[model samples]
Target: MCRSKIFRICLLFSAGYPLFQMTLRLIERTFYYPVSEPVDTFTILDLMFLGIVLAAFVSLYLGREYSDGVIRNKLIIGHSRMSIYLANLLTVTLGAFLMHGIFFLAMFLLGRLYGLPMELGFGELAPAALLGFLFIIAYASIFTMVSMLTASGSVGPVVALIIAFFLMIMGISIYSALSDMYAEIPPELLADPGFNPLASRPKWQQVLFPLLYNALPSSQAMQLMDYVAYAGAAKAGHLSTVVIEPTVFPLLAGTSALYDLLIATFTTAIGILLFRRKDLN
Candidate 1:
């Protein structure tokens, strides 16, 4: 336990502390919009912070599993790999939850100091706050599962990043399928950018690309951007002036949780079942 503590202290400084610093910078640069109301959706800081936390946890999970042989021999006690996985999950979730709770407290006090009409009512804000916590945790878990399966935890972030690449590629690949179907429509309507979701691609193609994009967990960043914007705008009371809808960000976040669960379960199940039969020699 003493060794685990010392090792974690080092790892936190090496990876996690840098992530927190990045989040601090992100909060300063990206969360600078004028006051409108209290928090509602997410901000760039929120999304980037989530990614930073996810990446940090993934890296460490992989690092720990890789170092497991040494830890077991040195400590004269070791858990089954499943125990290791669960303990890591709990540690990541708890640490992030506590840190974010403190972050929210700091943001609230800062908002109050600035005389912003930020809502502090637990009844009103608790659900949203809880949902955000769950969303990040779910995202982290998916990244962790991927790290364990890849044999190189370092590849976790790259795989998560590929979701963005998938979106760009899938979008271009199906643009032709969409244009061909929409060619029969009125030219003026088809020409309008606002009509593009349906007009740019047939329903099937639209749904297909979204599926491919969703398969990449990082693709959820596109959706979470709306939540971040809403959180900022809500804090500033900018929502009233905005004509656009709230975009159901919570639902989208929930969908991300589901996607991560489905994929992670499959990946971990395969790895654990395989691990039981393997021999390093």
Candidate 2:
């Protein structure tokens, strides 16, 4: 995997993209916005691109291994199916982290040069960073599961990328619905007794939208970005226009992290079971 052309290209992207974004943002913040104080430099949303990148890389890597019969050769050499599955999971997860770490390093270095600090302190940042890492693991588990079960290396990437794209679209749709539903009403509308916002929506939508937003990895990523934005704003002693209530920030972050943990665990277990029964022929 390390020697593969795909791996090298991903590494370059992981590092270069963040640097490019940071530079653009810095220029924008300096010339267009012209803030007097340092601003928040990084957010979990910055790493969201990794979803598609990792999906493609993991699927293609596993596909190459499958085509070359490396998986079968490992079994022939006495490695158990479970061991092989876990090994792949670990490798892919590590690769994802390496990419994430590179982005972080690039962002941090650039932010420092531009005199922009992360705004949120260590205590505030740690949990968000940890949750972001968990999201990465969840992404790896999902793509690894899809690729490992697939017989054709070529087919694996297509399936994984489709799933990633679908999840992203679904997440965005849910988020937008929730945002519209919860958006603040005008004072006149609020005073009108007949204008209850919740009255128009079905009960199921009210419950399901929040549940899906917190549960899906892509939605969680979006939520984290909002959380980070709100936190940065609050830490800077400014009013946050972000719709998420600051009081529920901890609750949302905790719930999102829990979902990520559950996703990674569930996907890995199911992948192992399915791979054990998969025929190499």
Candidate 3:
């Protein structure tokens, strides 16, 4: 756990934060006609940026040790394999959270400059924060497992990043499909015989959508982003635009956190068990 390296990564994240916002602002100024809406600071795009940064940093940080045989030296000295893995897991998890914080700090500051409202109230945002935190831990656990499994410096991070982006894409697609189910069908549309497509779906599909959404970390992040956007609107005194049910927040947050914890625990346990028996050579 080298503090200096972590600090350097954080500094890079801090720099990227403003660059991201500036890009969005530039888009609003140059492309969006009449600047239709405030730039959504709390969004799925945040996940993309943070995910790539953390994935690359964690992979390189751990991969270097494998390339240099530092892990083998640690094993020979007396340090338990479990401890080494856990330390790396903790380091990456904390680093992910720190990067998120730096981005949010920039978000709030940037929002103020544009006269944009805050994206979430304390009450509404708490559950999202908790869910996102669990997700970070889960991500760290899986990435750490991949890093430990691969011997090459270049392969681990690339694989982890690919997996991260793939999961995020899947989550977003699932959420969008489910969102169609939740949408209220207009009476005129329902009256059309050909428009009964949604009604024709099996009962099990309806039952499975929320369960699947709550189980995926990326879906949870997406849901949280949506809620934050609504909350931001409400905070800005446009409460009428907020359409999501109040109960949905607690349910999604609770289930997502539970799922993330289970994943983190399972991945860590498996990683530790495997690395213990792995030949360092």
Candidate 4:
């Protein structure tokens, strides 16, 4: 069953990988790709990374749920439900890491083909890989929780993708509101560099929205890619910021890691609890 799951996953990504890579390469050559503009918006990395992450995540969690015929045959002399859930989580996380490994390999090869320098210290690369894997794993767990309410493998990823889409829309809406209110400043209001754009309320405003408006995993992935973009640009002797609409208090990738860990705990615990009550015929 485990081997079947891995095989299916590899097959799915194998078909999808070439198209995404080709598109990215085309975009890079045209120089009309993501992050080329002055206005901040989702970059190509955002879509590619998120698409890969979401696909891998949904495949792993939901795939595991249905792939194991024996596991679903809970009527047999069964193992502990708690053990089942933990096993699923562990398996899903391992799947996420494996998927991430594939993604990074593809990305690095593409980077090399495009003549981009792909150098990084082993220490830096290790943590980055760990962070990316964790992000995907957490995201998969959340979607797995969603799948518990439904019965289809397709349902889990479709719902997650839709929800993720809407999350991006919501972020855009918030960004639009922020832009209209701030980007077009009065000449008298904007001449100073010390003006705080995101400072309407005190710094504590973050706490209020932390739950009200969560950042999408793609946007957060883009946040990391943006840094990679910046570092690449800076290496070329340019220090300009990437055109991602600045969050008044931009959540760095590390900060997103903190959020991922916290959110994963809640979502995964709930999923485990729900799995315990699963009525497998």
Candidate 5:
């Protein structure tokens, strides 16, 4: 399963990346947008595509095991349910890592091939990538829990996919709203100090949103990609303060790691307890 699964994942990305690049290039030539570069075009592909791909892979993978009675057989052979769950979790985590690694390599290769400007050096990119990696593992853990908990193999994938999609949407929405919170005060608003919008908000509202936004796995992905986008522009010496301030880099990276760890730990614990009592018959 491991060898074949890894091969399938590699094949998916190998075929997918070139086609994605072509589509982006076609869009660039046919349509007009401010940004034009391979990396810039390709960086955010993971934001949506990663979850979709992983959701599909994980659901189908675990679902198949149940349908084929592999889990039942393992249990009959005296393999503890806990071991089965952990083993599958570890395998899927490795698969997720491999998938992301391939995508990352492809992005870099394509970036160089197309002469895209990369503003952030390894110091910046490394941390962002690490946080993003943690988010992916966390995502995998949650997907595993869902996949295992569902009774129908056929329906499990669908449920997991829905969950993945919902979280992605929720994360993006929260990130956008929180980002708006920090938008520069308008010149007109500055003149009317009494009309300060941010000042009107409760202290907890200000603190809670960013914390919630950062808690989401999707936000980690968003922040990582956004960081790359800003870094690229800065490298080209075309920084845009109005649209996005890169000052959130530290905050994004730090919170991403913290939240991902907490969520992953929580999910794994819950998954083990639930799976132990799940009736295989």
Candidate 6:
């Protein structure tokens, strides 16, 4: 994995992209905004592309291993299919973590160099970081499962990429629906005492939207990004003063982590079971 050119390229991207984003943010904060508010080191869109990249990487890696008979050779050498699947999962998860770590380190160092305030303290940042790690694990489990189950190495990446896009689109749709449903009423409408925003929406949508938002990995990423941005703005004394309640944010973060763990565990178990029954020949 270390010698793979794709891994090397991903490493480069993981390290370089943060620096590039920080530079752009710095420029935008300095020249574009009239008020010159403190630039946030973290953005709501930070990890949006990570899912697609990891999907592509894991799919390609597994495909190569399958094509070159590495998996078959491992079985011949007495490794169980379960063990092989887990080993690959662990390798990819660690690689994803390394990429995430590089991004965080770059963002922090740049934030310091550029004199941007560290908005969230260790207490607040730790859970967000853990949530991000769990998210990566979930992504790894999903792509590894898809890639391992598919016979053709060439076909795995295409399928994995499609799944990644589908998850992203679904997340976006859920987010938009929630936004529209909860949009603030016009002042004139609010002036009427009986106006109720919840009355117009169906009961099922009220329940389902929030459930999917918390449950899906893509939606969780979006929520996590929003939390980070809100926390930063609150700490920086920006106009967006209404911050998420301190305790509420932690509870939400914990819930999101639990969801991610369930996803990773469920997907991995299913993958191992399927691979065990697969015929290599």
Top TM-score prediction, candidate number: 2
lDDT of 1 by residue, 1-281 (tens): 22455335534443444345444544654578443433433212343345555555555555555545443442246557676555665666565565555555444444444444444344444554555565456555655565555545356557754543453345444444444455556666644557744535567766775574444444455445445556556655655322122346567656766776676576556656654454431
Residue runs of model 5 more than 4 Å from their true location after superposition: 2-11, 22-38, 117-126, 187-199, 202-204, 242-244, 247-251
Worst 10 residues of 6 by lDDT: 239-248
For TM-score, candidate 2 versus 4, the one ahead is 2
By the lDDT metric, which is better: model 4 or model 6? Answer: 6
Cand. 5 Cα-lDDT: 0.71
Candidate 1 wrong stretches, greater than 4 Å: 1-44, 71-79, 116-125, 150-196, 199-204, 212-245, 277-281
Global lDDT of model 6:
0.76
Flag the better candidate by TM-score, 2 or 5. Answer: 2
lDDT of the structure predicted as candidate 1: 0.50
* Model 4 vs. true fold: TM: 0.68
Note the Cα lDDT for every prediction shown: 0.50, 0.77, 0.69, 0.54, 0.71, 0.76
Clash list (residue pairs), candidate 6: none
**Order of candidate numbers by lDDT, starting with the best:** 2, 6, 5, 3, 4, 1
lDDT score at residue 107, model 6, on the 0-100 scale: 71
Model 6 spans > 4 angstroms off: 28-38, 41-45, 121-123, 185-200, 239-247
The true-versus-predicted C-alpha distance at residue 135 of model 5, in Å, is 1.1
Which of the predicted structures, 2 or 5, would earn the higher lDDT when compared with the native? 2
**TM-score list, all predictions:** 0.58, 0.87, 0.80, 0.68, 0.82, 0.86
Residue pairs in collision within model 5: none
Using TM-score as the measure, name the better of candidate 1 and candidate 2.
2
Better-scoring candidate (TM-score), 1 or 5 = 5
| lDDT score of residue 68 within candidate 1 | 57
